[model samples]
Target: MQDYRNESEQFDRIVSIGMFEHVGHKNYREYMNVANRCLKDDGLFLLHTIGKT
Candidate 1:
């Protein structure tokens, strides 16, 4: 995700289904930040993860 940081190339939408769980708790902010940087202001972000019951 670091490769996406500060990049001029951005997307109109991003989907992270089943991926955020693998990022771990420690890197959540950084991971999301990277995605944020890669998304346009009016873009949409979709995140899906399995929760423990």
Candidate 2:
């Protein structure tokens, strides 16, 4: 996944919805790296997560 993101830089905007909870804390950095790499300079990134009481 890292390699793909590193090479592709192909997204101008990223919208990830409802996918956060599955990513454990140990893999958060990996998730961030993918987002950071996929985003174009000055591009927009949106993330939506749900919370439970």
Instruction: Check candidate 2 and list the clashing pairs.
Output: none
- At residue 39, candidate 1 shows an lDDT of 90
Worst 10 residues of 1 by lDDT: 1-10
Q: Best-fitting candidate, measured by TM-score? A: 1
Per-residue alpha-carbon lDDT of model 1 for 1-53, expressed as tens digits? 64434566689999888978887889889878888888999999998888786
Q: What tens-digit string does per-residue lDDT give for candidate 2 at 4-51?
A: 334555588888787766776687788778888878898998988887
Clashing residue pairs in candidate 1 (N, C-alpha, C atoms within 3 angstroms): none
lDDT of all predictions: 0.82, 0.75
lDDT of 2: 0.75
Cα RMSDs of all predictions? 2.8, 3.3
Off by over 4 Å in 1: 1-8
